[model samples]
Every structure is written in structure tokens, then in C-alpha cells.
Target chain A: MRDILTIEAVEKKATRDGFGQGFHEVAQSNSDVVGLCADLVGSLKMQAFIKEFPERFFQVGIAEANMMGIAAGLAIGGKIPYACTFANFATGRVYDQIRQSIAYSHKNVKICASHAGVTLGEDGATHQILEDIGLMKMLPGFTVINPCDAQQTREAAIAIADHDGPCYLRFGRPGWPMFTETGSFKIGKAIQFSEGSDVSIFATGHLMWHAVEASKKLVQEGITVDLYNFHTIKPLDEEAILESIAKTGCVVTAEEHQRNGGLGDSVAQTIIRHNPVPMEYVAVNDSFGESGKPAQLLTKYGLGIDDVYAAAKRALTRK
Target chain B: MADIAELKRIASQVRRDIIRQVHAVSSGHPGGSLGCTDFMVALYFAVMNHQQSFNMDGANEDVFFLSNGHISPLWYSVLARSGYFPVKELSTFRKLDSRLQGHPATHEGLPGVRVASGSLGQGISVAIGVALSKKLKGDTQTVFVLTGDGELQEGQIWEAALYAPHNKVDNLVVTVDWNGQQIDGANDDVLSLGDLEAKWIAFGWDVMHMNGNDMEEVVNVLNEAKDKTGNGKPICILMKTEMGMGVDFMTGTHAWHGKAPNDELAEKALGQLEETLGDY
Candidate 1:
């Protein structure tokens, strides 16, 4: 396992790039894997697959609902369709289409959403979706995976294709650290980055990078921080959560999503059910993100490295 | 192949099933179900080359999707009478733990139903998807979908309307049940669907027209619509029908769009139609 304190992240790539590459790789292996885009082929990095197999690619043209239904239809027809769009359009805009056609029907469609959370940047609140985790996870039989970094996102794209049934794979826009190694990705399995008996830091998506930074900073300051990457938010690694909290005695959840229904809530629900622990949530506190640089948005929305650090301190104090 | 008379007899039995199913629950959509009976019966019994065994993939056989899923009573009757499920299951319509849900769902393991639908304006896109899958697999079978005239009000329907022709999805045939009545009132009185024929033609579909209630016309137009496929354009049939076609009191108004007929009313409705097939 790579140490969070000294792990080098020399390359920075957007998680969507990993999805595009992974999707292309999966298409190469699985003929049943078809690509459908809501006019965001280039943005979603679906071009490579489209170029390789134009016959299998479908350009749904700005219609997210139709794209969702079509994906469900394709699934029904024995095809594994990756319905690609932004997080905002993928979940909130087409919830009903997904509910009836995909989730309720139990169709094997992969809803791959790019540009998730505040990291979507300048497009602002309209494009950045903070409640997508809640929207997707609430659906029965939905596998919601919010992979951290490019390598994990790529593996997720390929992994979900083999896993039968409906899935919501969320990735982001900005070029974040490509630190997580390949072949380490698994759905519903958490990656424990460091072992400590102080505050356990559970993080997902873009905020996982910040949590790593926060953990390293806390470790330098004589605080033992247990860090785990919660890639799959729906079939949550509850055993890992309970085990970690049992050791650390307190917990802190970090994510670039709403405080109400995102990673924090999932962790809280697990804790409340199992062994209750004093927990702090590092997330957007029920406010829509505004136009700003990706880094500025994170800091402004209380999802920065400092936010995780502060939240860890609060959880530790309560413990 | 069953002649028009036999098809009409099956349709009469289906209408009786629809009325009885809705009347037993007293909380299902009878108006549209009653209205679309002839079309459903003709398609299942006469038009589409489908298997009663019901595989979800529907490979090598024509697959049907009921987009306007509120008419579950109609679809349940057609599926049952055609031997997709036991005809006795019709009595359990809208009851607890029934395969025949208030809306047609695949969740309960309903044999004929491939997709869950009660939310309108989604079936055409789904049909197009299945059609695309058929084309990819080199299967020449057609994909059929039925939508309500009022369902066109949903933006996703138009999105599919734009998509099918642009992609040359020719193996798909979508029929709009232009029943003229919705839950509130007539479509024109509610939200006018002006020039539906012109609209589909402009959307680049091979358009056809038929009276959905007339078994012969329904069978012929559906076959015509199927034959029109694979020529590089999707087909559309603008089917005109009365909302409550068989039951006198249910017809001509949208009042029975979702409301079930009372015991006396159901008996009266059953009195008009001869149970050509034995009642379930």
C-alpha cells in the first residue's frame, strides 16, 4: 500500500479521461458494450470508442431523458450501454426516465456521469450537482460508484461493464492527482490508504485527494489519522467503516457534495446502525456552488484540505 | 391466421377482461384501456410475430412496448388472452402482490412486459433502442411501441421523434393512440396536439393512419407499418380511437380515463359485449 504521507502524484489527469480510455478498452473486449452520449461525446471523452466502433456509438443529441430510455432499451436488447452525460443531466434531469426504464425495470445500463460536484467549475450551480449521490443511491438496485482519481475511474468504467445491473459511475472534469495505482479498484470495497488509531477519515471523489493531504498534515502534527477511500457510495463498505471507527473511536467524512444526502449521510447511516460514533462531515452545507476556479470552489464551499483537517479535529475532540 | 371476425371476438373478450379487472380494483385506468383494446388484441393475435414464452431480449421476434402504461388493464388482458400468462391472473389485477400491477412492470416478473412504464413519453425511445439492438445483431425483426396522444406533450417523446429519423432507425414502428381524451378532457381542450400527421411527417417518419378500434383497419395498418420498416426511415401510425370505445357510459368523455366502472356499470358494460371467449 502506498503511504499517503509520501506518495508521489507527478501526473494530474481528469477522471473523465480515465473513463474515456477505460470505456474504449472495454469496448475493445466486449462487443455488447455500446456507447450513448447526450451530445457530450467530446466532453465525456467518448471519442476514442466512437472512432474505434462508430457502429456501436449513439449520439443522443442533448436529450438526456431519451438517452436514458434508449440505454435501458439497449440493455433490454442484451447490450451493455454506457449512457454518458454530465452529472447534472445524468441524474437530476433524467431521474424519472432512469427510475422507470432502468432502475425499476432492472435494466443493465451504466449511467456514466462526468463533471460532477463543485469541481465542474465556471459552469456554476446549474452544471455542478451536489445531490446526485442521494438521487442515485436512493433508487433500489442501483450501484453508485464515485471513484477517486483517473486510474480508479478508468477501472470503474471497465469493472461496471461486467457487473450486471444498473450503475451510476460519477467522475469529474479538473485534472486532479493520478496517485491511486491501477488494478486496485473494486466496487463496494474501500481502499485504506493509512492506518492510525486517532480520527478515521472517509472520503470519496475529488475530496479524497484533499483528505489525503489533510491526513498527511495531521500525521506531521502528531495526530494519527486513518484514511480510507470510499469509491462506491451505494453498496458502502460498511464492514470497513465499522472496523475503522472501532479502532479510531471517531470519524470524519469528506466529499464534494451536499451535506444532506452524499457520502456523509451514507457514513452516518452506517454508523448509526452499527456502532454509533462521533462524526464530522466535511461537505457543502446545503448551498449551491457558484462560479469560481475549481480550487477556489472547493475552498469556498468548505471542501478544501483545511476543511477536512478542521473536521477531523472536531471529530477527534468529540471522541 | 385468425380472420377479422375471430380477432374481433378476442378483442371483445379482452374488453370484457379490461372492464372486469378495473371494476374489481375500482382504481385503474379504464378509458384508455377500453379504447386501445382492439389495437392491442390485433397486434398480439394478428400483427406482431412475437413469442408467448417472453424472453426479455426478444431476439428474432417482433417486440411490443406499451408506452402509455396507465392502460395496464388493456395490456394485461391482451397478454393473458394471448397465453403470455395464465388468463386466471386477470382477476388479480391491481390487487396486492399481483403480477398485474396498476402499471405494467417487469418487476413482478410479468412475462410479456419487458420494461416498466406508467410514466408516459418514454416508450418510443425504448423501442428505438431495441430496434437499434436488432439492427446491430443483424436481426430483421421489428420493434413496436404504443403511446398516447396526450403523451406527446412530454418533451422526451419529441426528443425521440427527432432521434429516430436522424439515425435511420427504420426497424422501429411507433403508434400513437389518438384517443382524443385524456384525464382532464379531450387533448385539444387540454393541450392541442395540432397536425399530428404533419408533425410526424416533418420528423422524417414514414407516416400511416388507421382507426385503432376497427380490428381489420388496426391489423392492416399495423402490418403496413411493419412492412414500411427497414427502408431507411422509422414508421409512425397516427391511430384514431374513442377513449372508452366498448362501454357506452365510459366512451365520448375523459371521465373514465382512470376511474373504474361501478359493479352495475361493469355489468351493463359486460352486457353489451358478448364473451366470445370463456371469461377468466
Candidate 2:
């Protein structure tokens, strides 16, 4: 885990900012990259892209399901449409549209959802969506991706344009420090940050930094750890997961999502298939989050670094 | 203008096809399919400017989307009889491994269906998006969408209803099959769709009403809707059609909305509508 720790943050930025930058830059080369928003343009940081490509930007005005249908239509017309909305409205509200029009029909649509999970902060359960990953991953032929930070989110948002199918690209609201440099984002490959022979720490989305911090604290306590970032959640990097589990024998999965059907369950499914491993999850238990500071909510909902550290210790005992 | 007699001939054939196809499967929507036959026949054979050869993007041509997709028998019949595919393929309706899915899906590679539409209220937004695409591309062709009045109860229909006119999607036309019957009962008994034309006008649409069961009227009003396009408003036609227009037993009720006919009833329904074009 020390290799990822050594890759220090250059600056702090939100994953949503990365998405905006990536989409704006991608629109320059691929003229087919049409953008759509349902009255959350500023919240999704799509203003700049809209200004540059005015004709391609469609403001659907508080109608998320219609926005999804419009994007599906555009995709059918040989245009790559990115339907941007809050994570809750993007997945839960328009699931049937996405299922019938995009996923089942296999249209080329990018469902770019921002301000996902509890880190959306102070918006309460209405705005914060902790179950989006679960909702999207269940659909067949959908590539579900939740990037860790700004640089990775930018890479993922741009990379999905070349993929000719429906995808759900998830990002977050709060700005945090960047940990890794960009490039080398394969669709279903896991990145091994650092190698250790004890308990493996698997993390995704904004809580990735928490897992890194957990490894740092665990190193000082002489519990060597292996760390990985599972960004592409649907195509769950099963080979890398089994390889990591082969060495570590146990796991601790951290994500800013519900415990039942988030990244943790994916890892648990993979482990039980290839190699059985005792696993502990650092995720929101079966409950909704209330309005609070992002950091406070992280700590309160058992997604803090200390929680990861404790989960790893617990997993080691099972091993 | 098309030969009204020939259009009526094709409409009769489409009605026969709808009855036979649904009867073959024993589990498809026959009421809406039979009701909307004249409108679809008039549109494909007389109204729209489209090509016989199908492509996915549908660049530089008028496009049609079936928002209420339970009437797959009607769509498949019209699509086949109009040369989008073989008329013989209509016999495969709703069968396993058939391109003609219970709902229209593009993934099945079926011609004339650009988007899937069985889930109600979703197709109008697709039509609007294609209209917007044509506007962006400077393509002059228009887009048409057909929806059921009962399907208007879905909240997404209103969402798409609010979007098309607000964005000035002028190069589009939509027709709602105001048959006043759903799978449950009469539309009034199920849930009243109060003041539907006023609802479309209130939503900023250039609203028109017509008797969709009349082939000549269906052709004329759809073309009139076409002429009204690009005048800075989308058009919505609240077409007044019977629940099952030509079938003696099925007409004026929702009993045959999704239920297929038994063998005896199929022969009886087929007897009412004479086949002007050869059956598949």
C-alpha cells in the first residue's frame, strides 16, 4: 500500500470538475458528443461545454426521464449523448427509460451522474444516492464505473465515448485531494496501488482516500496491506480480485454506498466464486443519510479511515 | 394525395393482418392494433416521405415512432406491407427468436423501428430528440410519434409533453390515439384524461384533432400537421378512433385491448374486414 501513499496529491478538486473538463475536451474532437442536462447544468459543471457546443447541449428542464429518452433518441441517431443529472434522478427516476431504450436496445448513451452518495452533503437523502451503483449494476450490458478522484473521473468520462454501449459513469460533489496521475484506464481492469501480503483493502469512489489513509495507519501498526481501486464496478475486475485474494486471503471493501449491494457485495461475489475469503465492509448500513458536512457524514456512516482500519483488523482475525 | 380507395384497401389488409397475427400468437394487443390500422396505413402508404430501404440513423428522411407499442401487430403489419420488411415476416409476430418483439426494439435489427417503445410515454421524447437532431443537422424532414390516450397517465408522458414545445421542437408531429379505452375499462372509468387537447395547447403544442379511423381524414390531417411544422411549434393530434374499428365484436370496448381472439372469434373478426391485399 505504500506505493499509492507515495503518489501524493498535487491539488484538491471534485470528481465532477474532472467530468466537466473531460467532456468539454472530448467534445472538441468527437463532434458527436452531445450533452444533455435536466436543469442541473451548473451543479453538474456543464456550463462551459454548453457554451462551446451550444447546438449539442440540450437543457431538458427538470425532466430527468424525458432527458434519458432524448439521450436514447440521440444515440439511436448516431450521436453519443451524455445525459447529466444528479445520481438519484439519473438512475432511480429514469430506470425504465434506460432499461427499455438504452440498455435493452443497446444504444450508445453515457449516463453521467454527478453528486452521488452521501458526499453530496447537506442535500439529505433526497439528493444523495447511495444505491445508484446497485441500481445500475443490475442492468444487463451496462458498464458501471465509479472513479476515485478528479483525474480518474476525467479519464473515465472521456474514455466511455469510444465504448459503443450504454454506461453509467458516477462521480461526486465534494472536492478532495488527487492521489494518482491519469492514463491507462482499461474498462474492466483493477489497478494495484501497492502490494502487501496480509489483508487486501479494496476501495471505490470518494472513499478511496479513506482506504489509503487506513493503510497508512495500519503500516505504522505493522499490519502490512494490499490496496486496490475497483473503478469499473459492473465488470468487476474478477481476475485481479482473485489474484489479490490469492495472496491476502481476506479483504476489507470501502465505498460511499449502501452495504447490501454496492462495491462490497461485488467483491464478496468475486471472492466466493474463485477463492473464498473472509471480508468486512466499510459502507453505509441499510439506512438513508441525513444532511451534514461531507466529512462528518463519512465518519458518522462508518466510511471514515478509522472504520477501514478496524474492518481490516476484523478481517485478519477471520483469516 | 393518394388513391383513397387503395388506401382503404391497404387499411383493410392491415386490419386482417392484425387480427390473424394476434390470433396466431394468442397473446397480443388486438384492440389498439385494429383501431390504429387506418392511421398507420394512411401514414406509411400516403403521408410520410420515407425510403423503402432502412438505415439506423434515418438521415434526411421523415421518421415515425410508435410510443404505445402494445400494438406491435399493427406496426409489424404496416412495416411489412409498406416494404420495410417482408410481409411473410408478419407471421412471426411475438414468437420466440422473432425480430418482431412484443415491443419494438432496434437491437433486434428490425427495420422502421429506431427505438424501443413498449414502456409507455417514452417515445415522444425520442421523437423530439430526433426532431432536435434534424434541426441541428439542418435536415428538413419531420418526425412523427403515435401514443395511446390511456398511456398519457404515465408521468413521463407529461414530462416529454412539456419538453417538445418548450424547446421549440418545431419539426415534429405527435398523434394520440384517443380511443377512450385501456386494458382495464373505459378511459373515463379507469382514470379520466380531462381536457386532452387543452392539455396539449397548455403545454404549448399546435394542437389538432381528427378521426384517425377515417383513412382520407387520417392522411389529410397528418399532412396538414406536416405543413404546420417549422412554424415554431410542435403539433399534437388527438385522433378519435374506436377501440376496435372494423371488428364487430371488439369495437367500442377495452375487452380486446390485449386479449387475443379464440379460433372461432378470429374467423368471425376476419369475416368483418374483407382482405383487399393478399394475406401473408
State which candidate has the highest lDDT.
1
Going through the candidates in the order shown, the clash numbers are 0, 0
* Cα RMSD over interface residues, candidate 2: 1.0
List iRMS (one decimal) for every candidate.
Answer: 0.4, 1.0
Query: Individual DockQ of the candidates?
Result: 0.93, 0.77
Residue B273 in candidate 2, Cα distance off native in Å: 1.9
Q: What does candidate 1's lDDT look like per residue over A183-294, in tens digits?
A: 8999999999999999899999989999999999999999998899999998999999999999999999999889999988999998998899999999999899999999
Best TM-score among the predictions, by candidate number: 1
User: What is the fnat of candidate 2?
Assistant: 0.72
The segments of candidate 1 whose C-alpha lies over 4 angstroms from its true place after superposition are: none
Those runs of model 2 whose alpha carbons end farther than 4 Å from true positions after fitting are none
Local lDDT at B166 for model 2: 82
